[model samples]
Target: MAIGGVTIFATLGYFALYSNKKPEASAKDVAKVTAGVAKPGNTRPR
Candidate 1:
């Protein structure tokens, strides 16, 4: 029972630290795609 509890907490902690973090390359790729589809006048300023 103690081992199971520890395992569960470890899993939760791992996800808490890493779940919302994305790769830098992936973020840049998404930005490029979004900019590609955006209208010329509606784009964000750099």
Candidate 2:
């Protein structure tokens, strides 16, 4: 039971830390980040 709880906590913690806060982006936004350029709404990956 302790191990199961720890596993669940770890999974949730990882997602909270590394999950993409942006679920959707405009084409212009996608283009900028991958091209190593910055657009108005593009954010670098955390």
Candidate 3:
């Protein structure tokens, strides 16, 4: 039971650190996606 608790905490700590250190998506990429809405064709997804 102690081993399982440690494993769970370790996984949670790893994700916490990973998320804090993760890179954000670039503005260009964000703009590209936003610009897709302006296209003349049907915008609604099937």
Candidate 4:
């Protein structure tokens, strides 16, 4: 039971660390795509 509890805490800690690191490249890509589609040429939101 003690080992299982430690494993769960370790897993949670790993995810906590992972979530803190945001992907800046993906954000830039999304902004580029949004800017392109938001232009007057493309009125429909995809």
Which candidate wins on lDDT? 2
lDDT (Cα) of model 1: 0.49
Q: Which residue segments of model 3 deviate by more than 4 Å?
A: 22-46
RMSD values, in order shown = 12.7, 10.0, 13.3, 13.2
Candidate 4 residue-wise lDDT at 45: 33
Which stretches of model 1 miss by more than 4 angstroms?
22-46
Winner on TM-score (3 vs 4): 3
TM-score, structure 3 vs. true: 0.46
Write down the worst ten-residue block by lDDT for model 2: 12-21
Model 1 reaches what TM-score against the true structure?
0.43
Clashing pairs in 1: none
- Candidate lDDT (C-alpha), each: 0.49, 0.56, 0.47, 0.49
Residue 15 lDDT (model 3) = 55
Across 1-46, the per-residue lDDT of candidate 3 in tens digits comes to 9999988876665555445441553333333344443332332232
lDDT of 4 at 36: 46
At residue 18, candidate 2 shows an lDDT of: 41
lDDT tens per residue, model 1, 15-38: 553444344324433444434553
Question: In terms of lDDT, which candidate is stronger, 1 or 3?
Answer: 1
**What TM-score does candidate 2 reach?**
0.41
lDDT of 3 at 46: 22
TM-score of each: 0.43, 0.41, 0.46, 0.46
Q: After superposition, how far is residue 20 of candidate 2 from its true place, in Å?
A: 5.8
